[model samples]
Target chain A: MANNLNTRKAKQKTLTVLKFVFLFIYLVVVMFPFLWMLTTSFKPSSEINGPVDYIPNNPTMENYINMLVKGNFGKYMLNSLISSTFAAAVATFCGILAGYVISRFNFRMKTPVYLLFMITQMIPSFIMLAPLYQMLSKAGMTNSLGTLAILYANMTIPFSVVTMSGFYAGVSNSIEEAAWIDGCGYVRALFSVIVPLLLPGIAATAIFAFMNSWNELFMAVMFVDMDKFKTITVGLNSLILKYNIKWGEMAAGTVLALVPTMFLFGFAQKYMIEGLTAGSVKG
Target chain B: MKSNKRLGQRRNIFIFCMLLPAILLPLIFTYYPLIKGGVMAFQNYTLMDIKNVSWCGFDNFANILSNEAGVDFGQIAKNTVIWVVVSLALQFTLGFALSLMLKKKFKGAGLYQGLIFFPYAVSGFLIGIMWRWMFNGSNGVINDLLMNLGLIETNVGWLAQKETALLSCMIANVWYGIPFFTIMITAALRGVAPELYEAADMDGASKIQQFFNVTVPSIKSVLLMTVLMRVIWIFNFPDLIYSMTSGGPANSSQIITSYMMTLVYSMDYGKASAVGLMVIAFLAIFTLVYMGATKYTSED
Candidate 1:
């Protein structure tokens, strides 16, 4: 019995040690690229191509300063902010109302409407991209950020609605029914009861919609040529495109562009995971 | 009955009022452009001739098929297939392993998840640019490492070589996509009930057996859905590849989306539109077939 107990304890210790070792390797593989990008961003441009030394002997802010001075980094940052915020706000508002209607009322197209929204999301985003450019040009709004916001809103609303529907589904209808019995209308009950409950979903959808618009490089690169109108993703992409090869400055720009997105994700990660798992796990 | 019908009609109108923005947005943006774009596939249109276009019914398709449009689309189609199947299969496998390993009661799981999902937030174009920096022929981290490790005697041009350009591009894609599948399947794995595992454990099933018999069956729905969606996504665009290689090394990595962009390069939207239509049609047929098969089999 003593031998058996000793062997069991030894096996348990071995398993624990094995698990820790594998976890360390997993962490290294996952974090290496991002941390490399961070380290490379700080290193002097001269040392960028040197030996396999991960750390720079001398670091400088020359690349960041050069990028800011030589390029439209500030302007593009503002452009992305304006475009992404506008898209997120409008899309979330539309999604809230539509979700409320879906959750509250029964209509002929209730099931079909939900399915349609899902299908719209499933279709290749680029399938209509080329034609949309022409359509935008026809409307004489290809270069306008206002028009970009409208397009982004359309692209994100289906996702927003699907997510909002889930949020509403989770929040019981009993409270809203109580509101209705208390002489409230559909819109009133939604505003007073359901809206507060769906805050996390709205927050998640808003962050995602913002990310979608902010990170939209293809359309911006294709459509908007005017420097003043272009967003950050397009601007950085064009910087790389027009100039074939510049490692340090491009890395600097990419790093700068990625900062805000990481901050937003850091804030809304819990909600985003909940939204993702709850929505797609059933599929 | 008429009064009740009128009241019901009023509620229906109210619901429609709420749904107007949802309906109108996709109609104008998605449906209208889809039709307009379909028409472009039939016309000889250019960015310059948007206002003044001439119809060229099936010419683009026929010309592409016959190799008359200077596209040699047969080659692009082949490259596209090679790219989609290889990278997608690898991504699936990597994603599966990551999900399974992470699904087990391991420490640092949250940190692993956060790090993995970080890549997905970076724009596709920026991802290409990031990889380009890593694959820089003269001064890349990868080359430096390989040399230091004595794996290579000299610097090897990664993106410039035809043999490795597609694979290099695939490396970037796999890195970007691994997170999406991991997060999705990890969540799916969590939904697997403990009782099934307990039952398997009681039967003296090994850990590996429990995985195959319990875990796989539990997440099959998520697996199938993600596979379809990921294929649809990866198959459609060459934007990421374009940002990386631009179908370089004598068009060795040319896919349909990259081919489309090349048309824009040559100012030949007429042909690009046809390829675009083919892509959409292919997806449409796939959806129909998959849904048909599901309905037929599920009756059992």
Candidate 2:
């Protein structure tokens, strides 16, 4: 009996060690590209070629300065920020209403409304590209950041609605009922009572929507033709197209583009994970 | 009592008003374009000559299907299949393995999870550029590493050659996809009941057997759904391919979606719309069949 127990302990220890080893290797594999990009971004143009060093020997901010000044990456960054923020904010606003109704109310058209929202999540955004471009061009809205924001909001709304509804479903209605009994209107109760409770959910939905718009490439590329109006992704593509081989500048630009999402992810990792899982798991 | 009933009706109207933008925006932006795309597929539409846009029944589809435009629709379809299947298979396997590893909590797990999941938030376009630079034949990090390790004497033109361009793009895609699988499978694993594992252990089931019986069955629905969703996403994902190769090296790396992008770029709206419609129809059919199969199996 003692021998068996000893063997079991030994086996458990081995398994634990194996797990750590596996995790370490996984971390290296996952982080290598980002680390390489960081190092390469700092390297001077001359040192970017030939044998690569894991660490930059003479790191300089020239690449970054060039990207901001000559490459006009600052303008692209501003464009992305405006579009993503606007889209995420508007989508979340619409999502809160739709999600609340779906979760808290039952109406004659509830089933169809719910199904419509769900079906929207399944369709690819690319299918809407050609026609959306056509429609926006007809309205003379093409090549504008406002049009991109509207399209992005449309892309993000379905997922945000689903996520917000999931979060709302978890909150009990007793608080809202009490608010109502105390003479608060539904809107008042929602803002003063339910909104506070759903802050984390709201954050999650907004982050998801923001990330969607920020990272989206296809729609931005299709809609925006002018360099001044281009978002980060499209602007980067233009840079690559114009300059055949500028690795340092490209790396710097890529790293700059990643900063906002990375910071957002770092701060709100829990909410983002919760939101993503909630969205997918419920489906 | 009558006033209360009227107030209730007012509240319903208020709720409907609140929901108006949610419903109408999708109808206008999403469904409208979809319908327009369908209509445009049957017409000889060109952005350059919008005044001459007229009905051209089945011609656009035939043009692609018959390889009339030199786009080689048949090869593109084959490449699309290969791209989706290979990427999905590798991603799902790697993701599942990573999830299983991450199932049990350990030191620094949070940090590791953050790093792993970070790639998912990065734009596919940026990822393509990063990988393209790394795969450059003359002065790429990959070649430097390989040469230093004495693996190959010469630098490989990963994205320059027809034989390796698609594979090179697939590697970047796989890297980008790993996190998705890990995030999803890990979440699903968390939902698995602990009691099932204990019960399996008590029944003298081995670790492998317990995993197959308890873990797989519990996360089956999530696994199926994520896989199906990924398949559709991958089919429609053109950013990485567009940025990396632009379906170049003689269009060997071009998948159907990127081909559609190329068509759009060349102002062939008719062909682009037709391709878009075909992709939508294929996804609809695929989703139906996949969901039906899963439902049938679950019943068993």
lDDT of 1 by residue, A1-283 (tens): 9999899789879976776676567667666666777778777766876665688678788778877777878888898899889999988888898877886678889988887786676555554777887778877988888888888888888888877776776777799999989988777888888788778888998998898888887677767889999888887776776745566777788888889999988788768877776667753
Query: What range of 10 consecutive residues in model 1 chain B has the weakest lDDT sum?
Result: B291-300
Model-by-model lDDT, in order? 0.79, 0.86
Among the numbered candidates, top TM-score falls to 2
- The CA lDDT at B50 in model 2 is 84
Candidate 1: pairs in clash = none
Instruction: For candidate 2, write residues B161-208 as lDDT tens digits.
Output: 999999999999999999999998999898888999999999999989
Candidate 2 Cα deviation (angstroms), residue B139: 1.1
DockQ of predicted model 1: 0.52
Cα error of candidate 2 at position B250, Å:
1.7
lDDT of 1 by residue, B1-300 (tens): 999999788778879989888778888988787777778889887776767788989998998888897767788888888888887898888888777767765556665677667777677777787787778788787788888899998988888998888889988888788878888898899888989999999999987898889988887778877777787778875767977888887887788778777775565667767877888788789877876765422112
Error of 2 at A32 (Å): 1.3
Q: How close is candidate 2 to the true structure, as a TM-score?
A: 0.95
